[model samples]
Target: MNDTNIKWDKIFYGRAWIANIIDIIQTKDILQSFYFKRYLLRAMMAGFIISIITVFVLMVKTTFSLDWGPGLVNMIGAITFSFALVLILFTNSELLTSNFMYFTVGLYYKLIKPYRVLNIFMLCFIGNIIGACVLFGLMRLSDVLTPDMVTMLDQTIETKIHTYTFQNILVRAIFANFFINITLVIAMQIDDVVAKMFVMMFGVTIFAFMGYEHVVYNSCLFVAGLFYEVDHLALWPALKNIVASFIGNYIGGGLIIGLFYAYLNDHGQFKTHRNK
Candidate 1:
């Protein structure tokens, strides 16, 4: 076959990117329409899993930071932290960051309405917060917050809230979800479980190690801080970071990746293929 006639999906070893995007929209439609309770539960589950993993990452980093220092500690923490996304994806949990891309694509194709998108976003965000709070309460009850762990969390929160400029947080937030959703989009076109896990780990680790802001992860951290008597954590600054991260994540994932891909692949040729 000529290059122009090549079956691109075969080259990708799975469905084409546009096909994957359509599949995501259809799958989400069913869940959102008939199984919304489950959808909300999955969002909460994602928040819970991330919160638990964040604590473990802080604990591990705290233990190693003294001997390994910041660079190595961050690398280790990043790698360890990545498993949270892996778990979330495998469990079919809903994450706001990835959803930013998914729903944006759905919107582009007129598969979902704007108001419904906003509703889903709000529901996922609120559910994530609820999940984070529940995890914090469980940790408190279990008495798992050690002095070092608390200290680590406080320091982390301080950097996120007080140390960085608003512009810095915004940029970092953009890159964070950009990496995450890019990984998700590519992973959707692959079939191997191990490959998907590796892609997720690599993408998450890059963002974590770079100290990029993620809205959901930041929410979990902030919730933990509220549960504890943290020295450096303040309400206003935390809110600022959250707001900046939320906007930046939408720009990066929804506009940059989702719209760009939809526009690229949903032109005349793909529409004709779809009609066929």
Candidate 2:
């Protein structure tokens, strides 16, 4: 195929990821225009859903780890965890990590302003924290978090906070969101619901099994850690990890995938067609 034919093929052959990006930008634009309270509430709902999934997946992992061994347990946990994103996307929930890509693409296309991007990030993050806290409180009131479960959570928090260097945490966070946004990109292009769910699950499984850092997931975990006696969890260390992970996730999802693809598809023949 000649250059023009190749470009047309990309557009017609289900390879036009930029089309999905445009759709995301338009959706976000509508959401951003909502009243502040309503917008934040929507974000909080997303956060709550994410926290619910996190708790479910962690509990399953903790329970299974005793009998299944680490490898099998990790796989099971990762697979279970993948449902988090599936739920978020299908339910029209706002997750900060995925929004990193969406808004980045918006910025690249000049569909969103930098200030607005920052505003959305702040609102989404605060909402996520609020939701996590609410769930943590509920879990504490309930009898679900056993001593063994608390111990497992503490160990995981310890490793994230103290065992890894700053750079290590940052790098892991990058890869974690890279996988996450990549999943979102691919899932958006797919028309089949089952196929989309599988894509999301598979992409998330890689990051979860690898024990990569994700800021929102870490938020749920850190909040839960507060409920139990922690061996190595400290306020400063946790905050540091959160900060590093946030920066890394932005780099991975926003800069790497979002901006890179925006640039790739917004040029030459693709650009011409998009303009037309």
State which candidate has the highest lDDT.
Answer: 1
- Candidate 1 — which pairs collide? none
User: How much is 168 displaced in model 1, in angstroms?
Assistant: 1.2
The per-residue C-alpha lDDT of model 1 at residue 217 equals 98
| TM-score list, all predictions | 0.91, 0.91
lDDT of each: 0.86, 0.82
Displacement of residue 109 (Cα, Å) in model 1 is 1.3
RMSD of each: 2.8, 2.7
Candidate 1 Cα RMSD (Å)? 2.8
Give residue 171's error in model 2 in angstroms. 0.7
In model 1, state the lDDT of residue 163: 91
In model 2, which residue pairs have backbone atoms overlapping below 3 Å? Answer: none
